[model samples]
Target: MRQTRRAIALFLLVCSILVPLPVGARQAAANPFAELGLPELAVTITDTAIEGAPAERTAGRYVLAVTNDSTAGAPPVVSAGVGFLQPPEGMTAADLIAFFATMATGPDGGASPVASPGAAAEMEGPPPWYYEVPLAGGIYALPGETAYTVLDLAAGEWVLWAEDPTAPRPPVAITVTGEAPANQPVPEADVTITMTEMAFALDQPLAAGPQIIALTNEGQQPHFLVLATVPDGTTVDDVLQLSMTFMDPSATPPPNLSFEQMQDIANTADLSAGITNWFSVDLESGSYLLVCFVPDQETGIPHAMLGMIDVVTVP
Candidate 1:
């Protein structure tokens, strides 16, 4: 009887080890693209240059895996531009380099890329546009914070470059050679954030976890989502006060938490007016903020100041 009992116990233990885990008990998968059922274009970004970018790809729904491989320096940020760079008549290499440098400085205190000299006219407009994705190594450098942007690209020659002027790598040239891939099923969004001319509208707060957030642009201009975590006790007023100094340099900035204290998680690249796009993000539980920093073409004022800023809670 004792021997039969031992054998039965051992068999049960083995069966338990071999059996599959219950769906609810299994850990959630982390691949953002896989979870969303979208094709992925893995792109590695470093302080010097981008690597593993395909020279040619089929135009279609693609999730850009923009990984910030820079383990040092300021946190890295990247953006993609699709267009030909045609320097104006008789523009020198030195001039071209200077033009790129100026463009990299961003709009705040830098000269507009639209009006720069030399190759300032390099990028032809209308078809030319840029998109940005926020990467990890932020305030806390939280793991698995890789940024993603879904792009429905058309067949054409495209250019991808880092928005950070300091990155040493040259621009990458990509050719969209084939037809776009088939559309994938859109994942259900746990939280949907609607964006207007200069404001953000969300139905309610978000529960922390791997989540799909849908961004709908209902305004007349393009906008993007930057997910950031503010320090505990930080309020909307504190953010606004700091903004005053940013908008008007002469104004005494609030002594509240500056940019250094905030941790950026991810960003949804530019969503054109009337266009909607969704991306997957690992939402950690914390106090967060959503803002669109894109400046208005007419006023040159950041959309965040136009009431695009909002405090978000991820519990």
Candidate 2:
């Protein structure tokens, strides 16, 4: 009887540990929110210029732009895009690298990847362009961007980067915030800034980082997003800070903004409906106008005249 009780107690004790689970495992299983808070992150896409881009890019250069920002949270991002094409026939991106690692020889005396010239020689395979679609951690396209995939991204501050083994060896580093962002996507964050029938329709304001400004089709018309900002060479303090506590709608673009400002408005025109696009920028907190240039170019009437402008705040 004593042995039986002892055995039973031992079995019950083991079962208790197994049934309740370890503190960490239980925490992981009970409610995911309690551990990671929420899987959602503040990831937004933009076409803004890369914060750290090498002036000249050629072979062995990297081009990167912010595809997504998780705000200031971590496990840094170390990733590459999937659209990298392999070298054909006998050569490859590796060959390109090998070609450069050695001394450049004259026609009389060349290097390892050299032997003769053929139809294949002129063809550099990947064409030195590693195309990539925007990327977001938690927020992703349901069908996925067919042209791109997730490459090895180490844990640290990282942004999307592309490498070319050709000439113009420039290095581009997209901004990757030094923090971790929500690992989930927010449907509401996918905003559509449409311009049609001379009216603007945006549910909320844009922050100072990255975002996706989608343009929908009312007709077969083209639309764009434009906002006002300080003139070029202006300091951050000179920026006109503005925000809509109640989501206002009367901001306007500055007169004669720089070429970059103009491009910022046009780059958001990624042509995949229902598929969100991404861009990143380090913008100053301020008030600005958002409008689209979807008007008939021949008619000389601005797209905003048809109602694509709205007010937004960055705080």
Candidate 3:
């Protein structure tokens, strides 16, 4: 009898080990894109140059994996914002570099006209060539960390560059050919943030945890989202007031809020009208302010000043 009981107990233990996990547990561990089989492009940014992008790709949705590896200076690049631009016909990468240089310093090497808020509005809009180009959204990543963003690209020649004007790196060019694959898998998003003219509309309230966000630009002009955590008792109006001082060198700082109190959580590159992108962010329970600082097409004033700021609670 003892021998028979031992044999039955061993069989039960083996059966327990062979049984599969529940469906929900398996789904959570699976890769989100495993079924779609999307091609991934790895982009690396260093202090001197950008690398690892292929010269050609099929025009379609792509997962851009960006990594920043700069360690050269005090306060090294914590986060690098990469931007994609489709230059107008007859323009070369060199011309785009020259334009960025002129925008940083004046044509005569004097202070940039954009440095003064009053002059920025007074001056005529960007050169005519600027209007012809299209702005595609890109991703941001911290130093030594990898971040991902899904970009649906059309057939064209695209230019990739560092979005920061103060640290302009040589831009790289890539030619996209063919149409995007049909029936692409749309990411399952926990929240959707829609960008309209000078405002942001959220589909649902946010919860504190990892979230996949779908960002869509339905507005007439280009826009981007920047989510930052502010100190307790800070309001959207206070953030707007502080932002104005950053834009205008002559404007006075707000008495209540200082720059040190705010911490940037997530940011996206400029996305033109009709562009949609998906990114992932993890937030702790707190108050976050979402603001867009992209300048208006006609007036140079940032959208945040025109009431494009909102405060949300993650509880």
Candidate 4:
């Protein structure tokens, strides 16, 4: 099981570099929220640091544009997002950093355990502090790609980071004050995908080519979207069987189908409940497997195994 988990992680890391941007260009022509006149936060991730976060801003909706400027040799994948937390009065950013360090080490003063389908069920629950910090959804983009997401910031202290622990960069702290902007219009979406308990609901058929996708987490727990292209004649049952082999430690993985056989086209960071975000993607005409690997809060099983897996045809 440990080997299988490691193989999957390595596969994701490799896919981050090999996956082609669905959109042909590296940058988008305009901000999706440009018409709303919202503040635009330009976040650039390079080899050295994460740049463009302001020290303070008025509480309101803003467009977060994340650009990956890292070299091919640098970390090819970046998960940049905003995390909101309201610590007790008088708490400082340094205090929060210390808290994060403790969380990373777990209660045993050792490294935290990797989350897996088998191990998740054995856990009691996340630490109490986990609920205190809410992650605002962000982009999961590769080098040279720029992705956008809408952030509705409230008056509070928010931290922006790469969300990768091995990167060794400090989180950027922002103080949001004043009233939030009112009556902001939601950006138009080409297709809307709603996440519910152990299922995904699509408002319309997903067409081929570049289009804005709106993702809403209506489920009680957090969820994410991952779309990968599969060969012709592939079915949802085939995906389920492959995933089951990967999740089970005792089962031997099938030789015919492996993670390397699929091409991952889209991956989004986890979004908390009631949070809606948009991303743009373009896919070739083919069948793609949509699955969410988020573990269930109660059973620790991945949502994909519980009927969240589906094959959508892009025509």
Q: For this target, which candidate reaches the highest TM-score against the unseen true structure? A: 3
lDDT of 1 at 140: 11
Model 1's TM-score against the true structure: 0.65
Model 1 gets an lDDT of 0.52
Give the residue spans of candidate 3 off by over 4 A: 1-36, 72-78, 92-125, 128-132, 248-252
Candidate 3 lDDT (Cα, 0 to 1): 0.66
Error of 1 at 70 (Å): 1.4
Per-residue lDDT of 247-304 in model 4, one digit per residue for the tens?
Answer: 4556665555555567656677667788887777777898888887665676645677
TM-score of 2: 0.29
Model 4 lDDT, residue 18, Cα: 26
- Model 2 poorest ten-residue lDDT run: 20-29
Candidate 4: give the clashing pairs: none
Candidate 3 lDDT tens digits, 195-262: 99989999998788888889999998878887777666778877766655534558776787766566
Q: How close is candidate 4 to the true structure, as a TM-score?
A: 0.75
Compute the lDDT of residue 269 as modeled in candidate 1: 47
lDDT of 1 at 222: 62
Query: TM-scores, in order shown?
Result: 0.65, 0.29, 0.79, 0.75
State the lDDT of candidate 2 residue by residue for 217-293, as single tens digits: 34333332334443344332222212110012244423443223321222232121122332222356765555443
Task: List where candidate 2 sits over 4 angstroms from the true fold.
Answer: 1-190, 208-215, 228-266, 270-276, 297-300
Candidate number that wins on TM-score, 1 or 2: 1
Whole-model lDDT values for every prediction: 0.52, 0.29, 0.66, 0.63
Q: What is the lDDT of candidate 2?
A: 0.29
